[model samples]
Target: MLEKIFKWILTIVGFALGYAATEIAKNWGFINSIIGTSNIYRIGFISIAIILFGIIFYIVSPFIIKLIFKLTGFLESGIQKIPTNDIILSVLGLIIGLLIANLLITPFARFLAGNTILSIVGSTLTLVVNIVFATLGVNITLKKKDDLYNVFTFLRRFSKDKKSKADSKLGISQPKILDTSVIIDGRILDILKTGFLEGPIMIPSFVLEELRHIADSSDNLKRARGRRGLDILNLMQKELMLPIEVVERDFENIQEVDSKLLKLCQIYNGKIITNDFNLNKVAEVQGVPVLNINELANAVKPIVIPGEEMNIHIIKDGKEAGQGVAYLDDGTMIVVEGGRRHVGEVVDVVVTSVLQTAAGRMIFAKLKSAS
Candidate 1:
């Protein structure tokens, strides 16, 4: 029924177009002279043109309908995926652009009034300017939305009292943005639960999507890690006092998740919370603050001075001969020199030195008797 209605509408439009074309042709001096002022002939020509156009439109309507449906579906899906804030901003931008276009085109419209061709050109120019400006406005607004939001929030707080002044002095605590590796490591939940992390915690939509991809991966290890991340997120949301916000904003132009996280941190003036060493280094290089969980863990571990003694069970051999490897409760590696012979036994060792690397802290030790 809809298809039939659509075909009928197309037929009517085609007939009107044909009649308009005939009228335009009739206005030409040569065609007017050729018709010899015969009204009957003109009527017959218009009737034939209308019938031909109507038949053509009816035959082609199905393909046109299909194309329209495809375009509608594509647009609907795209719009649905866009965040509500972005859509609102884009619409606001479009309105501002149209207003600017109107201001610029009014004078041109008046100047070109006497000439039809020039008037058409002015109208086309107006349309082109409107489209270009609208597109630019939307793109710019979306890209700088976080900054704009911050500005507005500041303005809103400007009228507040002494507490706000103190807050200003203390500096606004920017949200902590979580990355994929941090999520998979799953210690973030505990950190947040401890109230050590201030400000809102944000997980970007892209990061969540990456987690989903990992969770769906065919590799068992990756799948487990991904699932663990998701479970941690769920638990954080359920049991933690701090709200975990899932941010829908994304940098569509950025392909790498780590790069996107850094860009987002710049936008939000936020620190990234992650266990990824490479991400931590890159973010630091780019002047973005990073809260590395591994670094934090290392910092809080028992500080062992050289000559301090502790007992450890040698579970495996180290890369160096006669060096037995043991792990602290916190997963810190302790290398015991001359203790390879004591594998599978617990023995006293004296800490000889401590080495700190980007990865973590390592303790070098010798058997207590040797020390």
Candidate 2:
């Protein structure tokens, strides 16, 4: 059934081609002498041409279909490698180039009056001009695709200010891009309530996808974390003063979620909000702005200097013999030297040295009695 449809389609195409070929032949001296002022012979010749071409094409339709499929697959693969922005730029370039080519062809199009050879040459030149300009347009647009993209993005930012786009206006702050890890951490909700951070928080669709996958995870721990993240997002949307902007932009060619997040930061001029230490370091190295929730938590914790005395309950033994480990309310680890014997008891301790580390803040101290 499908084969017959394809054959007829190709046969129709062949008929059109035959008509086009006859029109071109009519421009030549040989064709005019053969069908000179004779309407009946012209119709007969055209019908014969159409029927002959249709039969030939119908017989070769299978090969044509195979070639078309091959060409389509090749084009699909090639186009898949190219970014959507580049394709738009290429099209824009082609239009501009064709326009220029048409303007340039105007003089020659009129000058070549009647001479067949000169007219053919002129037509060939016009074709060459259009092809050259079209190629140039595609090349130039592609070459400056980034600049053009930036310009368009800038325009869109203004045009879509009140829309679901980012609120990165002239005085407004860059949108804070939320990642899955930070969402799961859930401390950002408290921070949002404090109003210390700027407005216009954005959650990318890819990050949301990861969060959903985590929520749907088979493992209990992961599923809980994912559900907690979703819950936090829901709370933010319902309670927060600033409406959460869910960005649907995504990089199709990028496989890694982190890489896509970083790319999005660059594209939208947004800062990533994540508690993942590794991701924070990667963003720093890439010069992409990142707001680390862990960093913020550590910063807001009580600052204790050396010689400051504080009370803590010793919970466990530290690595060193007779060293005791305790935690402050904010979860800062306090190591009390020579207080291992006092484990499971609360005691006053004097800070000896405070150390700031990537993981968090750690304090070294001695038992107040020993001090």
- Model 1 ranges off by over 4 Å: 1-172
TM-scores of the models, in the order given:
0.59, 0.66
Task: Give the CA lDDT, 0 to 100, for residue 229 in model 2.
Answer: 98
Task: Kindly list the per-residue Cα lDDT of model 1 for residues 199-243, writing each as its tens digit.
Answer: 689999999999999999999999999999999999988998876
Quality of model 2 by C-alpha lDDT: 0.87
Off-target runs (Cα >4 Å) in candidate 2 are 1-83, 95-116, 136-170
TM-score of 1: 0.59
At residue 147, what lDDT does model 1 achieve? 81
Task: State the lDDT of candidate 2 residue by residue for 1-371, as single tens digits.
Answer: 87678889999999998888788878899888999879998898888888888889998999988888789899999997888777888998999999999999968977984688888888999999999999999999988876885676567555554643434444667789998888998889999998988868999999999999999999999999999999999999998997689998777868999988987887777789998888999988766778888878888999898989998999999999999999988899999999899999999999999899978899999988986
For candidate 2, the 10 contiguous residues with the lowest summed lDDT are 161-170
> What are the RMSD figures for all models against the true structure?
9.7, 8.3
- After the best TM-score superposition of candidate 1, give how far the Cα of residue 125 lies from its true spot, in angstroms: 12
